[model samples]
Target: MGGVAQSFGPFSVRRLMDGVFEAPVADLRHLGGSGPLAAFTAGVAGSTLPMDVNCFLLRSAEGLTLVDAGCGSAWGARYGHARAAMKEAGIDPGDIDRVLITHLHGDHALGLIESESAYFPRAEIVIPARDFAFFTDEAQRAAVPAARRGGFDVAARVRRAYGDRIRLVGEGAVTEGIVLLPLPGHTPGQAGYRLGSGENALVIIGDALHLAEAQAADPDLGFIYDVDPVIAGDTRRRLLGEAAEQGWALAGGHLPGILRARATEGRFVLTAV
Candidate 1:
């Protein structure tokens, strides 16, 4: 799969992971109503559905900041050739100055590792405080069902290796231009980032909206892995409304390209440009 690069105002965005499979549209009806199902079927076609799972690298005057790391070596069996895509983009793991993890999901955080060590040794790994607390707690891990326990394990290993370098940011400015907005419910402390100076801004909605068509058309739908479906749905609805009203550029963790169009009310169409 080929990666794409796009410019959103002052920030430069690039797709680090291009292809991944997701469930069919019919399966999405369980999430909410028929709107999402119809949008998914129409926008995404063909069997063996290959959707893009992107990691964005933002370059600013201060330094290079990565949004989410794609599937690491552990998930190679499923995603294949983890680091090759980033390498192709000319992003050296060592050159990354900061890594902002949207959540602790394996696919998003796993690629932080390189040669059995944390991938960005010189970079500070920023995570939401609530998510860090939940994922690192031993009791929480034991309480989760077996099927979801693997995620906790991955979180544990990341915490152990990068304890000192891990920085926690709540709903505020992590850096000068990057503001972390709490978008919770996808995971306990999942967040979206708003970049740029003022009214002209782009919201890096990390996993807050997974599939562009499904989410844009029906913001109430939830993905299967969503930790709190109700909250996720509500957040999605509110964010979509706000983004459309504000005319903000929206980017997502699993969206197909480096940048995707925000749907206008009633039209249900995407303008990628």
Candidate 2:
């Protein structure tokens, strides 16, 4: 969990560091090969990419809202420390009324359960409709590689625990100010939340670009975790263009910190905001 906090409109947001893991470079692929892109991927192949699993905690008059839950006890003791981080910050888990899931991946959804039950006793698990549909479909499990098939199990476990408490939605206003932005391809229904507007605006894009700098420079690169890599790249390109044009900042589950898109030469790069 992070001690730093930023304000967006009437909401105070905190990026809670849930866990950190090394993402293998081999998992990345170039949707379309470019000389520079191919070389970049090859250069990083033998190494691991360090990524942070972060969850955002938003506070407003509407109570507390959490964006994505860490992998609670899901991957064993190596992760799932976000709960303690929250407690350390004097946050009561029961106060969180909404746990907005970006996708059904373990780090994002499995935290909804603790001791084989809902972690937040009172929070409504708001999940993207498309993700809920696709991940839950046993038929769709075959769509992804066996290594990436874990989302199906994660989705089922979360669904079973949350049960009637789960709320499925497409792209729309989640509350008074927060809006869900449709960012598919990473998963069939990866959701990003837009907060505030303009220069001060912040968008919590979940795994849209696992490697912000690498992907920002070349939006065609995607992780093997992506169900539809092509669409994922498209979404990344669109979002980067939008952010650069709109002067908005982006935050993500794997992204280190808040970053803004800046067009350098003919390519775009992410600069810390």
Candidate 3:
């Protein structure tokens, strides 16, 4: 929560741990049950998985930019500590000039609003074009399960607050040294931001792969929250492959801290950066 979590070129990335939660192993399902269940569960501690709810702050010559927002005042006592986290880091909400959202999920986008208004009033919100179109489409709500409609509600709230300040982007440069890479499947527009290139590269993938060890071992394992488990699995594997080959330092919405990917025969080994 203090100092640099990882550095990429001139950018210093720091993690802001909002809260923690326990995910039952039962919630993790494999694609068509094709992956090795025994090995996947064996990598996990027990039936319950304790994961960190994290967001990152990216500092560079371009100004203050946040990778993603944590759960705001909506998710209850276990979350919604953004203000406190920012205070601890000696930063004010207004100081953040831009916010690059990885997706439109509740935990990823709900922090945009605080006290029924824009929390980062001065910041321009950057979101994936696909996600903006999907969540904003009211007709898509009927197709999505009622339980998964929370992200839709979040999209509405964010739009109502930020209005024209939101910018829809594709897979390209969102700012100086930051490149948006489309890695959909969990959500239609879910993506990661690549900072720099090659071994020193740091990729911020939010909710792309939740259980670091298990998912890295077998990306075929998808979480219950995934909108399209099959596509999510494919995306996970693709991202893992890219990360490993490039020797990327990875960060995520649910990861505890920064990790580097090492490719073995068929799996990736995550080492703390």
TM agreement with the true structure for every prediction? 0.85, 0.95, 0.94
Steric clash pairs (candidate 2)? none
Arranged by TM-score with the best first, the candidates are: 2, 3, 1
lDDT-better candidate, 2 vs 3: 2
Q: Across residues 1-273, which tens digit of lDDT does each residue of candidate 3 receive? A: 443656787788888877776888888788757357655777677788988888888888999998889887778888876558788778988899999999999788888888669999799999999988899998999899998898898899999999999999999998889999998989999989999888878899989979888788878887788988889999988888878888888899887688888889868778788
Once model 1 is optimally superposed onto the true structure by TM-score, how far is the C-alpha of residue 200 displaced, in angstroms? 3.4
Per-residue accuracy of model 2 over 1-273 as CA lDDT, tens digit each:
674889887789888888888887766678666665568866674578889998899888888999999898878877888888889888877978899999989888788988788889989999999999998887888766788898888888888888899999889888877889999989989999988889878899998889888889889887788888899989999999898998989999899988889888988999987
Candidate 3 all-Cα RMSD = 1.8
lDDT of each: 0.72, 0.87, 0.85
Lowest summed lDDT across 10 adjacent residues in model 3 is found at 32-41
Better of 2 and 3 by TM-score: 2
Candidate 1 local lDDT, residue 167: 93
TM-score of 2: 0.95
Evaluate model 2: give its lDDT.
0.87
Position 170, candidate 3: lDDT: 94
Which pairs of residues collide in candidate 3? none
